[model samples]
Target: MIAIYPGSFDPITLGHIDIIERGAKLFDRVIVAVLSNPSKKPLFTVDKRIEQITECTQHIANVKVDSFVGLTVEYAKLHHAGVLLRGLRVLSDFEKELQMAHTNKTLNHDIETVFLATTKEYSFLSSSIVKEIAQFGGTIDHLVSENVAQDMYSKYQNQ
Candidate 1:
């Protein structure tokens, strides 16, 4: 079955990669869909985020990277995906994701939201934290891939 993993992915972190890698193994195909949200100012543009995700997940044969600008459920339906994959790193994440899952259920009963618990190593990892660290000239090599780390480092270098 095709699964859609949607997120802002301002700068794809190891935690996000963990979910994508695991999701790829469970589903026939996993599309890493980046949300083109305009409200929040993201460190990376949607196109750039997609490119970064593509570069990071190149090792996974069944993973595809894309972007969308509408309801995630609609995007999933358009892509003919039967599942909406998400990752939970903490209780706060669970609370927020659970509400989204229920809201998504109301929007489309055909699509199922599946949540994966993040590994212990990435329990505290987040894109915001990654960006913060990078913004302060701190090393983010451990949070993201080497390529992504370079991108982050370069992005923050100018500021």
Candidate 2:
């Protein structure tokens, strides 16, 4: 089965990679989709985010990285992916994910969302936090992949 892991992924964090690595093992194909939300101010552009994802996930076989500027369900339909992979960090994430899962299911009844609880070590890791650290000139070497850290630093410096 093909699974679509959709996220803004402003900069691909190690937590995100952990989920991708785990999710990749479950499905024949895994698509790491970078979501484009016009309402939010994302530090990284769609192209930049896609580039980071590509660089970070280059070693993962059977995994493809791409970007979508519409609803995730719509993207899933376009890719013929029947499963949506989500990683939950804690209870705080459950409610929101539950709502999204239901909404996606309503949009595409055939599409099902599978939630994977993040590993304890990565439960607190997120792109927002990584960006915040990098923005404040703090080290994010542990939060994101080396390529991601470098890209984020480059973006931060340019801004």
Candidate 3:
């Protein structure tokens, strides 16, 4: 069945890619949906995030990249996706993710939220953490895809 993996993906990290790769194996189709939020200043634009995710996931034939601006459940409905895939990295992540899953369930009972345990290697990885490291001139080569790491370096070159 089609599954929608929704997130800001401000700059997709290796952790995010890990989840997408695993999700693709479980679902017939996996759409990496980037959320378009105007409130928070993101390192990358929605379009750029989509492009990065697309590039990183190109090897997975069943994975698609897109952006959305409204409720995630609505987006899932629009795509006729039966599952909303999410990644759980730790106990803290479980609490927040569980709450989001419950809230989404209230909005749409048909779509199920599935949580995938992040690979142990990526348990402590996140886009924010990567950006923080990059902002301070730390090596993020191991935190994100090579393309994403290059883009991050390019973006922070002038900062």
Of models 1 and 2, which has the larger lDDT?
A: 1
- Candidate that beats the other on TM-score, 1 or 2, i.e. the better one: 1
TM-score for all models, in order of appearance: 0.98, 0.96, 0.98
Kindly give the stretch of ten consecutive residues in candidate 3 with the minimal lDDT sum. 43-52
TM-score of 3: 0.98
Model 3 residue 71 distance off true place after TM-score fit, in angstroms: 0.1
Better of 2 and 3 by lDDT: 3
Whole-model alpha-carbon lDDT for candidate 1: 0.95
lDDT (0-100) at residue 13 of candidate 1?
Answer: 96
Winner on TM-score between 2 and 3 is 3
**Higher lDDT: candidate 1 or 3?**
1
TM-score between candidate 2 and the true structure: 0.96
Per-residue lDDT for 12-131 in model 3, tens only?
988999999999999999999999988889998988888889899999999999999999999999999999999999999999999999999999999999999999999998888999
* Residue-level lDDT for 107 in candidate 2: 95
Runs in model 2 deviating more than 4 A are: none
- Our model 2 lands, by Cα RMSD against the true structure, at 1.0
lDDT (C-alpha) at residue 147 in model 1: 88
Candidate 2 worst ten-residue window by lDDT: 145-154
What clash count goes with each model? 0, 0, 0
Per-residue lDDT of candidate 1, residues 89-135 (tens digit): 99999999999999999999999999999999999999999998999
